[model samples]
Each structure stands twice: as C-alpha cells, then as structure tokens.
Target: MDIHEFLELPHRFRWGGVGGDDCMTFPASWALKCVGVDPAEDLRGTYRTREEAHAIVDNYGGELAFMDSHLAKIGAKRVQHPETGDIGLIKAMTGETAVDQIETQIGAIRFGPLWACIHPGGIRATPAEFVAVWRLTA
Candidate 1:
C-alpha cells in the first residue's frame, strides 16, 4: 500500500489491528510494509494491553531501552533527523492505560516534520519534534 492507503488504515485498540488500533501496531505494521513484510502474516498476537506493554518495557529496563531493543530487532538505527518512512519512538504528554498511567507510542514518518499513527480520534500526524526517530539500517 502507498502512504495514503497506509495512513488510511482503520484505527483501533487491538494489538495488531488490520482494522484495530494501538500506537505500536499501527506504525510497526506500516514499517513492515515498507520492507515488503505483512504484519498480519508475520507479527500476530502480541502486546495486547497497557500492562503487557509496561511489562515488556520493564523487561528491557525502561522505555528507551525497550525502544533500542526493538529497533535492534528490526535492524533499525537511531537517527538525528528522520525522513519519510523512518520509525519514531514518540513521548507525548498524553498516554493511555487502564489505570490511568502513562504510555508511549511508536509511529512512522510520513513526510518531513510529521509522524503518523493511530491517535485517540483515529490515525493522525504528530510533530516529529515529539518523537525520537529510528530509521531502518541500510
């Protein structure tokens, strides 16, 4: 799918939503598509809740650590400036948890200055300054 189609993918709270929603899955799925991988075919049934997300991050030490580990897993590297198609580990002032705790989100760069992913109202673009970018290693 092209950027427009990817951006138009339905948003939901499910872990790996083809039509579901969640921060990580939305962009993670998109990143996989950039590499010619289908998330529904490869990444299925994982990180289904806020607690699960926290546990996974705690397992790797913390948010940044988890992001690093994840990036490494996908062969992506941290970048000072993200271009289109780069992944971003975003730290927004807002987060979602069943118990009202904070959380982080992952999104893909759709263009200069914008990181696109599933937000509360649906898929939207956030400022690149709001995230730490990671690009796939060449």
Candidate 2:
C-alpha cells in the first residue's frame, strides 16, 4: 500500500517499543519494510536520538526539514504529499516533553522510513487532532 493507506491503519504511541523514539522510528522503519527495504540494514545506526533521525532525513536530499533547523531553512510550505518512505514532520503538542524539544514552538512530526503495518492512531493524531503530513522524497 501507499503512505496514506499505511498511515490510515491504527497506531499507538509506545515510546519504548522498539526503542525510546519508536513513535518516530517504528513508523518510519515500518514504512521502509512495506517498500521491501529492511530498515535494520538500510537505516542501521541512523538514529540514536530524534535529532540524529532528523539529520539522516535532512541528508537524504529533501527540501523538508527534519527538525527546526531545516524547518526554518525550508519553511512549512515544503511539505506536500504523504508518500511511503516519506517523512511526516509534525509539531509536538503543548506540555509534551518526550524527547529533546528540538522545535517545541513549531512542534514537528515525521512519518517516513515506512513500515509493514500502521499504528493504532493514524500518523501522529491523538484522540483529538492530527497535524500536518510531510512526505519525504528524494
């Protein structure tokens, strides 16, 4: 399935599933798996922290921003489609402090690296709202 279809599946935010940042890495890793790419191999050691994940994405050659640095450089308008293997940059909610608040003011979410299945919640949507979807492309 495509990115939107995969994202349509249910998702739950388990901060400590595959890793602490599983919320970010799990989906991205799953997305890669859907495309028949083994994230363990293709994305090995790419992310030790959220910032590292963003850095890997930034170096991947997209105009999109992984964190505030690139976001400031490219702006929100850079986000377009929600393709598999694409990254979704979302803003963290107020009073949310899971990881290092890179760009808390703007809040950011990324759904890429694709996965085999979707999470309990669609993308980064909570019980209330779903923010923007940014597709990571080459």
Candidate 3:
C-alpha cells in the first residue's frame, strides 16, 4: 500500500499489538509495508505497560539506539530530507505530549508538511517535527 492508503487504515493505537503498536509502531508499520518485513516483530506484543516498554528501550541504551539497531535490519538509511512515507523519530524528551512515556521519543511518518503518528484515539497529525528520518532500502 502507498502512504495515502496507509494513512486511511483504521486504527486504535495500543501499547503493544501487531497493527496497534506504540507510537513508533505506526511508522514501523509503514516500514513493514515498504519492505515486507517487520523490524519490530520481536518486541511486538511483548509489552503491555509503559514501564515494560521503557525497559525495552533501556535495554538498547535509549530510544534512538534501540530504533537504530532495529531499523538497520531492514536496511534503513538515515537521511536529512524526509519524503512522503519516510519514517522518522520525533523528539519528545522535553515532555511535549503524554503519549511519550517510552524513551521520550515517538515515531512519525512524513506526509507532506505534516508528520503523522498513531494516537490512542486514532491516527493524528503531529506538531512535533522529525528530529531524524530514515528511508527504507528494499
């Protein structure tokens, strides 16, 4: 599916699940669609609480490191310019939103000028900018 179709997917974001995963899960889902592989497969459905999620992030020394390690498996390359459907890291360490309970960094997808993230209510546009971006090489 293309980014436009991905945006229309029905969702009720959850702390952990296959399709309804955490904040990063949203963009990670997009990456899966792009590459036909789940970079987060091992950790999905393994956490239920914020604390458990944080523990997983801590295992990798923090969110950035954790994501860097996982995304690498899918041939993710860091890029300065973000394009539509590109996955990115949105810095939330400053406590920008309550959705950031794990590693203080959330995942978002570039859709035009806006970044899209999965909110508890559903998919929503994020005001937070992409501090780092990755393009999947498949």
Candidate 4:
C-alpha cells in the first residue's frame, strides 16, 4: 500500500516492551509490515534509536530502495502529498534539548524528534510520540 494507505491504519501509541515506554521501535516496523512491507527485508534490525532509523532511511540507499520497492507494491509513489501519511523517521533527544529538562536531568530521557515525515495513517504509527506530520503526493 501507499504511504497514505499505511497512515490510515489505526495507530496505537507505542513506547516499548509490549506496552508503552519511550521509543517507537517495534510499532514503526510493525506499521510498515501492516502496510505489506516485509520488515526482515526492509528494515535494519539493529537500530537502537529512532534517530538511527531516520539516518538509515535518509542516507542509506538500501533502505530507501526498500521503501521505494514497497511503495510500488501498493501502487504509490514517493512523492510528497499533502493528504498522505508518510513514514515518520524519528530520533531521541537528550540533555538540554529534551522535552522535559527536569526529568532528563536526573538521567537520560528519549524524546521523539521528527527526522523523516511520512504520509497517510493506515500503514503504521510508531510508539514514539509523533512530533510532526507530512503528506505525500503523486
């Protein structure tokens, strides 16, 4: 399915460990699989943070190729459309950049920092708190 179709899926806020925690981790991958993209082939299993995932999707041609191939499977293009939910690549923020300084001051808190924007909702919604939304067209 296209990113728009993927975005249409009901999103449950994911944190971690089968319930909720902080990172979007499995939810994002699951979302992609829900949209018909094979996680084993499309995603790298070693990502420790959303930022790492975003970096891969951005700089790694292999990951982009995976997204492109899957988009074709759903008859969707990678074009940025206003009404579609694009795959959101995110990262964690720490130190003074965190959403809550006090909470992070004691240790390290991971926050969803939007790295990549995907369109539509049916595909998948990562557990990480959504920071922004975008649409893909054409």
lDDT: worst 10-residue window of model 2: 100-109
TM-score of candidate 4 versus the correct structure, residues matched by position: 0.30
TM-score, model 1 to reference: 0.72
lDDT of every model, 2 decimals: 0.62, 0.40, 0.79, 0.34
- Lowest lDDT sum, 10 consecutive residues, model 4, at 102-111
Ranking by lDDT: 3, 1, 2, 4
lDDT of 3: 0.79
Q: TM-score for every candidate vs. truth? A: 0.72, 0.35, 0.87, 0.30
**Residue 59 in candidate 4, Cα distance off native in Å:** 5.1
Going through the candidates in the order shown, the clash numbers are 3, 26, 0, 30
lDDT of 3 by residue, 1-138 (tens): 888898887777778756486786777788888899888888889988667877988999987888888899889999999888888888644323667444457888888887887766677775665668889888
Model 3 bad stretches (over 4 Å): 92-103
Two-way TM-score contest, 1 vs 2, winner: 1
Report RMSD for candidate 4: 10.2
Tens-place lDDT per residue, model 1, 1-138, is: 566777766556565454575666666677676775433333346566667756765877876676566667767778886677777777654455557645455544555567776666676676645447777653
Runs of candidate 4 exceeding 4 Å displacement: 1-34, 49-75, 84-138
Q: What C-alpha lDDT, on a 0 to 100 scale, does residue 81 get in candidate 1?
A: 68
Question: Looking at model 3, which ten-residue stretch has the lowest summed lDDT?
Answer: 93-102
Candidate 4 lDDT, tens digit per residue, 1-138?
Answer: 543443354543322212321223332443444454423344434454545644665563543453444445544443332222444323333333345433110001111332322222112222343232222233
